[model samples]
Target: MIEILNPTLLARARETGALVADILDTLRSRCAAGTNLLDIDRWAKALIVEAGAVSCYVDYAPSFGRGPFGHYICTGVNDAVLHGRPYDYTLADGDLLTLDLAVSKDGVAADAAISFLVGDARDAESVALIETTERALAAGIAAARPGARVGDISHAIGTVLGEAGYAINTDFGGHGIGSTMHQDPHVPNAGRPGRGYTLRPGLLLALEPWVMADTAQLVTDADGWTLRSATGCRTAHSEHTIAITDDGAEILTLPRRAREL
Candidate 1:
C-alpha cells in the first residue's frame, strides 16, 4: 500500500528510524574476525527489545521466503547478498558483511542496511563493491524530492552501479515503507527516468541499491532464504528510509550520532 504518513505518524516514524539506525550501528561495531553470525542476531534482538521496538523480519512470512524468517537480522557474508538468514558461521578477517534490519516502534516502521568489511581485511574488489553501493544510495536519495518520480531515483542509482561495472539485480529492490517494512511503488535499482509514481510530500520510501560483482543472477541457499551471487562473487548493498518533505527528502535512518553531528 502507498501510505502518506501524517505528521503524528511521521514523528513516530522518526523515532523508529533512529532506533533502527542506532541498532545497526551498534551491531556493526561488534562484528569482527571470530564473531559469530548468530551472535549478531542476538545482539539485534536485544537492542530492538531494549528500545521497545519489534523486528519486522523475525515473523516475516512471504511467498518468496521460508515462512517466519525467525531471525532478528539478515547476515549476508561475502557471497550472500539478500535475505541472508543468520546461521552458525564465524566471520573471518576481511569478510564482507551486510546487515539488513527493519523494525517498528510506536506502530511506525523503518528499514535500512549497511555493508562493511570485518576486522582489518579489505580487498580492493570488496572495497569497490561497498563504495559503489553507498554512492548509488546517495545518488538515489539525491533524486528523491516532492516533484520527482520514482524512476528518477532508480535511474540515478543505476547510473552509479552501471558506471562502476557492477551488474544490477532487479529481483529485489527498494519500496514504499511506512507502518510496515515493505509496501507498494516498488523501486527497482535501475529504470528509466520520468516514469513510475510521482513523489509527494509525506511519502516514505526505502531506497536501496545493491549489486553483484560479476553477474546479475542469484542462487538461493539451502536454507530457503539467503540469496547469493551465482558466480560466487562478492556483493554489497546500501539502503535508507527517507521521508518526502517540503524541502526535499529527509533521511530517517541515519545513526542518531550522525544526526546529532
Candidate 2:
C-alpha cells in the first residue's frame, strides 16, 4: 500500500527516521575486530526497546523469506548483502559489514542501511565498494523531488553504480516506506528516467543502492535468508529514507552529525 503522510504523521516519520539513523550509527561504532554478530543484534534490540520503538524486521515473514525474521537487525558481512540474518560469527579486521535497519516510532517507520569496513584495516577493494554505494544513494536522493518519476531516482542511482563498473540488480531495491516498513511504488536500482510513479509531496521513499563486485546474480545461503554474491566477491549497500517536498527531497534518515548527503 502507498501512504502519503499527513503533517502529523510526517512529523512522526522524521522522528522515526532519526531514531533509525542513530541506531545504525551506534551499531557501526560498536562493530570492530572480534565483535560477534549476535552481540550486534542484542544491542540493536536494547536500543529499539529503550526508545519505545518497534523493530519492523523482528516478525517480518514475507513469501520470499523462510519465516518470521527473528533478528532485531540485519547483519551482513563480506559476501552477504541483503536480508542477512545474524549468526554466530566474530568479525575480523577489514571485514565489510552491512547493517540494514528499519523501525517504527509513533506509528511511523523509516529504513536505512550502511556498509563499512570493520576495524582499522581498509582494503582498497572494500573501501571502493562501500564508497560506490554511498555515492549511488546520494545520487538517487538528489533525483527525488516533486513531480519527478520514481524511474528518475532509479536512473540517477544506476548511473553512479554502472559508471563505477558494478552490475545492477533489480530483484530487490528501494520502495515506499511509511506507517509500515515497506509499501508501494517499487524503486528499482536502474531504470529509464520518466517512467513509473510520479513523486509528490508527503511521499516517503527508501532509496537503496547495492551492488556485488563481480556478478548481478545472488544466491541464498542455507539459512534461507542471507543473500550473497554468486561469485563470493565483496559487496556493499547504502540507503536512506527521504521525503519528497515542494522544492526537493529531504533526507530524514541522516544520522546526527552525519556528513551532508
Candidate 3:
C-alpha cells in the first residue's frame, strides 16, 4: 500500500524520523570492540519504549522472513547485509557492522540504516564499500523530487555502485514507507530512468543502497532472517527516509545534530 502523508501526518513523520536517526546514531557511537549484538538490541528497545514509540521490526512477520523478527534492530556484521537478526555475536576490531532500524511514533513511521567499522582497524576494502554505499544513498536522495520517477532514483544509485565496481542486487531494495515500515512502489537499486512510479508531493520513500564487495548473490543464514553475501564478502548498506515536497526531497532521517543546525 502506498501512503501520501497529509501535513499533520507529515509532521509526525518528521518526529518519528528524527527519533529513528537519533537512535541509530547513538547505537553507532556505543558500538565498539567486544560489544554484543544483543546488547545493541536491548539498548534500542529501551530507547524506543522510553520515547513511547513502537518497533516496526519486533513481532514483524513478513512473507520473506521466517516468523516474528523478535528484535528491536537489525545487526549485520561482516558478511551479513539485510534482515540480520541480532544474535550472541560480539563485535571485533575492524568488523563492519550495519544497523537498520524503523519505528513508529504518533501513528507515523520512518526507517533508516547505517554501516560503519567497529574499531580503528578500518580495512581499505571495508572503507571503500561503506563509502560507496553512502555515495549511492546520497545520489538516490538527490534524485527524489516531485514528478521524478522511482527509476530515476534507482538509476542514480545504480550508477554510483556500478562505477564503484560492485554488483547490484534487485531482490531487496528501498520501498514506500509511511505509517508502516514497508509499502508499495518497490524501489530497486538499479533501473532505467523515466520509468516506474512517478513521485509526488507528500510521498515518503526509504531509499537504501547496499552492495557486496564481490558478488550480487545472497544466502540466508541458519536463523532464516539474516541475509549474507553468497561469497561471504564484506557488505555495506546505507539508507534514509525522505519526503517529497514542492521544493525537493526533504530528508527526514538526518541525525538530530545535523538537523538542528
Candidate 4:
C-alpha cells in the first residue's frame, strides 16, 4: 500500500526516522573486535522499548524468511548482506559489518542501514566497498523528487555501483515504507530512467543499494534469513528512508550526530 503521510503522520515519520538513525549510530559505535552480534540486538531492543516504539522486524513472518525474525536488528557481517539474522558470531578486527534497522514510533516506520568496518583494522578494499554503497545511496536519493519515476532513482544508484565494478543483484531492493515496513513500488538497484512509480509529495521510499564484490548470485544461509554472496565475496549495503516533497526528497533517516570512529 502506498501511504501519503498527512502533516501529523509526517511528523511521526521524522521522529521514527531520527530514532532509527540514532540507534544505528549507537550500534555502529559499540561494535568492535570481540563484540557479539546478540549483544547488539539486545542494545537495540532496550533502546526501542525505552523510546516506546515497536520493532517492524520482530514477529515478522514473510514468505522469504523464517517466521518471526525474533531479532531487534539485522547484522550483516562480511559476506552476509540482506536479512542478516543475528547469531552467535563475534566480530573480528577488520570485519565489514552492516546493520539494518527499522522502527515504528507513533505508528510511523522508518528504515535505514549502514556498513562499517569493525576495530582498528581498516582494509582498503573494505573501505572502498562501504564508500561505494554510500555514494550510490546518495545518488539514488538525489534522483528522488516530485514527478520523477522510481526508475530514475534506480538508474542513479546503479550507475555508481556499476562504475565501481561491483556486481548488482535485483532479487531484493528498496521499497515503499510508511505505516508498514515494506510497501509498494519496489526500487531496484539498477533500472532505466522514466519508468515505474512516479514520485509524489508525502510518499516515503527506502532506497537501498547493495552489491557483492564479484557475484550477482546469492545463497541463503541455513538460518533461512541471512542472504550471502554466492562466492563468499565481501559485500556492502547502504540505505535510508526518504520522503517525496513538492520541491525534492527529504532524507528522514539521516544521522544527527557523527558516530565515534
lDDT of 1 by residue, 1-261 (tens): 899999999999999999999999999999999999999999999999998999999999999987899999999999999999999999999999999999999988999999999999668999999999999999999999998999999999999999999878887999999988999999999999999999999999999999999999999999999999999999999999999998989999999899988
lDDT string, candidate 3, 77-163, tens digits: 999999999999989999999999999998899999999999899689999999999999999999999999999999999999999
Expressed as tens digits, the lDDT of each residue in 1-261 for candidate 4 is: 888888889888988998999999888888889999999999999999999999999988999997789999999999999999999999999999999999998889999999998988988888899999999999999999999999999999999999999878888999999989999999999999999999999999999999898999999999989999999989999999999999899999977773233
TM-score to native of every candidate shown: 0.99, 0.98, 0.99, 0.97
Say which prediction, candidate 2 or candidate 4, comes out ahead on lDDT. 2
Please give the distance, in angstroms, between residue 125's alpha carbon in candidate 3 and its true position after superposition: 0.5
Candidate 4: regions farther than 4 A off: 258-261
By lDDT, the better pick of 3 and 4 is: 3
Off by over 4 Å in 2: 259-261
Clashing pairs in 2: none
Give me the displacement of residue 154 in model 2, in angstroms: 0.6
- Model 2 per-residue lDDT tens digits across residues 92-209: 9999999999999989999999999998887888889999999999999999999999999999999999999999999999999998888999999999999999899999999999
- Model 1 off-target regions past 4 Å? none
Q: Measured by TM-score, how close is model 1 to the native structure?
A: 0.99
| Highest lDDT scorer | 3
Candidate 2 displacement at residue 23 in angstroms: 0.7
In candidate 1, which residue pairs clash?
A: none
Give the TM-score comparing model 2 with the true structure, all chains together. Answer: 0.98
RMSD of each: 0.6, 1.3, 0.6, 1.8
